[model samples]
Target: MSHRALEVLIVTGPLGAGKTTAVNRLLKAEVAAGRRVAVLINEFGAVSVDGALVDAERPELAGVENLVNGCVCCSLRDDVVATLKAWCDQPEGQRPERVVLETTGLADPTDLVDLEQEPELAGRLRLAGLLTVVSCLGPVDHLRTRPLLRRQVALASLLHLSKGDVDPSAAVAWEGDLRSAFRHIPLVLTRNGVAPTDSPDPWRGDLRPVPEGWEATAGPSFAAARSFTTAWDHPVDPAALEALLLAPPAHGELLRAKGVCAFAGWAARNDGSDRWAFQLADGRLEISPLPLRADGSAPSCAAVVIGTELDAAHWKRALRALEVPPAGARRKVTVRP
Candidate 1:
């Protein structure tokens, strides 16, 4: 860290907590103010779907970039360091005033905040804040207060609750649980990533409540959760696929699921179509329409699944039950510690 001037807001949250949506909203505000802000989005899967999902009224965000195939907490740390270095090296007038780094759902914000301590960015990149999104529609298993989720919630300066409209009672329970677990962190209600109209200044402060005996250098708490990537040969049926996602595998607790699926002719649309980007976090399923990749070609991925104490046999059995399949073998994506 060298004489830092660029402020970075690390937006994070548990799986399906709506981290992407929040970042997009933040970006719109920053851009509206005519401030120079760059958004770096990270995804755990080899194939990235989130970059496109960040789209809003702008169709494509102006200063957004994707860091996929690795979570910044672990494998893609170098990519982050390099990108920031490049930005700082730019002409003073050309550098962005702020950077919004949206970590993968499985990421640990500490891993990123600690980067400010490194010599390279020690004084150059400042931690603006860490914002975490937690939604009411999450899976029953995530409600158990897993260490990974707790760690995410604990490190936030601001907490954004998504899907509160779906279940008011569940939202209250979630807010209560988080309030009981962490102090001083403010919770904001959000829908489709829009920040609450009443939210106070987001950059007010930062909080680090690392539990005793927890080493800052220690790897993220996802050790209990296993993640893998699986692909099929062709497109899938949306209705049938949602059915399987709602009923997860019998083997383990599904914490997150996402994929770029082909729905070439599943339905008719006067408007053109690409693939349907699907994500399951906590247990809520969100599906969106995705355009082609940068090369003008569709993405080459089917799906990615992650869960705690994964039972491979049972997981594969569930995949076999998909309404449309028999296209190819399933390959698991590994997250190196």
Candidate 2:
């Protein structure tokens, strides 16, 4: 009897760059083909909004794990290795055929490439390749300010140019810059948040060793990024919440914001569901209703924002204002000292 290395793929991108969307599309297709696939999402926040988003989209998936409150590239690196080892130890019949790891925007993908050689994971897990998702619609200035984005691009085996449908001309211009900057890396344009099927799948092939001198210079450490998280049991006013996400207290430096929260009496046109999901990236906002859980219960309600110089007190105060009051109760206002 021979052992088969667990196939693994790494997906990296900047905040609001559509990493979750790309991963969801891939997982959806893999499961539809009857392949046993799992996704591990690393979010730089206390609550795992990305993980909950995955659950909403692919309720049937059983291996969606989230590593939150830390970046696996640094703080939680050991935990990631342990998880892979545990997966490898599972019985053959219960093990997944493929695993996709989605890294946080603040994560340095370069640090994680060493996972393939970990003693415990050496033979059990195989590194496929790195896929970096770049949002064509986002402000290019982020590239200059966020060095992690450059490192992600430099380490990628495949560059996924997302949001092409939003602005074709912008997408073309972004592609030109990417081609000139990352000329050696292969790139693909994605429309409607879906990666192309005929293209070289980011996680399907043998690992391609990054050439010498491909590593980008180090920039600000992960410590430069700060995250704020809020959770409320009560449903909120959707309009007020949307406004808050669109314009953070410190709007200029706020990079990414996303979460699943309870919306008062909200339901999709096709389905009567109460839970809703919202995402704000690079000033673009998206809000949609989540599917009902299999058990017919509401999902967790929480939101998180990651950026530089975030005012935690202001965020807390603003979120508190959006909470919907109970039928006979008055809204409570807290004055922070």
Candidate 3:
């Protein structure tokens, strides 16, 4: 029997980092190379928007599993293992050549390493590498405040930093700080969602919220930054949506925002298929044409925005300016940062 151990790679990053884009580009390239690959997406949100974006792009995957509504590092560890077991149980002809597990931005990368220590998985799967992405556009305090960032950096086989070209000087400082914080992780700056040695294709866009009338969850040191996720049923205007992202009210309070939005009418591209993916960060806005969807796939319209002094009222008014579909404004739920 010519049996091969399944290689498992873990990808982790902060909330706004470009992990999705990097993973997406890598998947496309691997598939193009005629490799059977599977992806396990762990999203920390009530709605699984990240999984949706990934599902649309690569339908021919060996298998795709999404563990949502909790971080896989803690609450969903069993679920993740179950997914791996199911994949391993597949017939030899059906098993994939490689398996990639993309963890929630808030996940502890070390936890995944711990999972590989399990006796059951040792024979079937091998932990290949760890890829940690860092977005330069996020507030500095946010990075410093995150609890597990140091561990993530220390464990990363490859450290990828994105959007550094936006500010060369800041990138230098960020790299220095990262080196000072972590032991000895090889760091690489990513261009257009990939490293210099890699050729590319491009790009894409969780968390539960705290609940209403409850004391606000104590946040990290990022008092100047906040993030919110929205899922709307109605269509949005592309131009209006762009303007809102590019020039949000309150004088540059918007730091970075990304989402999969739907639009109607003649200009609207949601002809029962196709998605409009929008990204805004570090004073830049981009609109990319997403692929037409697989059969019976529903339209995905969601957005996550990070900004200074951003609150529900502000976000609500901002989307309203673009006449966006209502994104469930009745609750005041937030996740512990």
Candidate 4:
């Protein structure tokens, strides 16, 4: 039996390093160049937001799949393999030119490299390259304590230095540190998630081989972190939502938080728009209005907060406060947390 070959690229990095942003940029470039591409987004939280963001931003590109609630490098490895096999089984004309898998920030992508060597997928799937996005704004201490971060850098074919525009002075020092530590890997300084034209294209190269006897280093268990999602059916107040993300629960340090919220009277606008997206990563908060869904339906108002040792009760109560009717409102609305 024979199978059509599929190029696979893995995008990975630490939490808030902008892996999805890089993937989005690549997808736009590929689509503009008339190349058919597929994207597999693995998110740590149950309520996924990255997939929606990609869909809104890259509506022209099809084949976007979301794997949420688990890490693909471990518990969901089998599912990941199955998804790849299914893609390979597709008819030749319908197949994508390339497939990009954006792993959760906590994942160690070394395990997925073995997919090329899988008995069922040997000829069908090819491991093209691994691109790791590193945030220049992250504290230097993370290099010492976060073994997963080290593993991401050590196993990458290319390193993307993200968020350098946030702090140019600090980025200079960070780049110096990274060059001293991992000088072998090719590095690209990117701004606004845009990679240079000369950046290597994984699809154009020969497939890379899986490393033999690969082992992951010990790090804080991803299971030790917890996530809480609050979903509401009706529209929410925009200011209340922004305030919530601005000062997340004090009990735990927020690693990442993102949401697609349905709002009414958002930003004092009367344009009749209903949805907005907000993301909090590495202590920066970004909130922007979402493009209206093509289907003419509003997405549920929801937010997922991920962190270490969060106080669930307090967080839930804080979220419920968004339910109360502000002064001059006709009626109090019901909220679910």
RMSD of each: 4.8, 2.6, 8.2, 3.1
| lDDT of every predicted structure (CA atoms) | 0.71, 0.80, 0.67, 0.76
Please report how far candidate 2 places residue 78 from its true position, in Å: 1.5
TM-score result, candidate 1: 0.82
The superposed Cα distance between candidate 3 and the true structure at residue 60, in angstroms, equals 3.7
**Winning candidate number (lDDT):** 2
lDDT of 3 by residue, 1-337 (tens): 6457777878888765778788887787778988888999987645565676687675478888888667777779889888887887788979987877898766666557765567667678877777888877765555566555555565677788888877776677777787777645567788767787652222111111212333223443133345677765566777778777766466436655777766644253555454677767556677666655566665566777655566656675556445443456432333232
Worst 10-residue lDDT window, candidate 3: 199-208
lDDT of 1: 0.71
Shift in Å, residue 87, candidate 3: 0.4
Off by over 4 Å in 1: 1-4, 55-63, 139-144, 208-211, 215-220, 292-301, 311-337
Q: What is the C-alpha lDDT profile of model 2 across 1-337, one tens digit per residue? A: 5458888889988888899988888888778988888889999999988887788775355477889999988889988998888888888777787888999988888788889889999877888888899999876665666677777887788999998888888888888888888798888998866766688877654445544664545554467878888777678888888787776465436778888877776644466567778899868879877867666766777778777777777887777778887788765445372
Better of 1 and 3 by TM-score: 1
Error of 4 at 269 (Å): 6.8
Candidate 4: worst 10 consecutive residues by lDDT?
202-211
lDDT of 3: 0.67
lDDT of 2: 0.80
Stretches of candidate 4 off by over 4 Å are: 1-3, 202-218, 267-272, 324-337
> Candidate 2's error at 7, in angstroms?
0.8
Please give each candidate's TM-score. Answer: 0.82, 0.90, 0.73, 0.88
Prediction 4 global C-alpha lDDT: 0.76
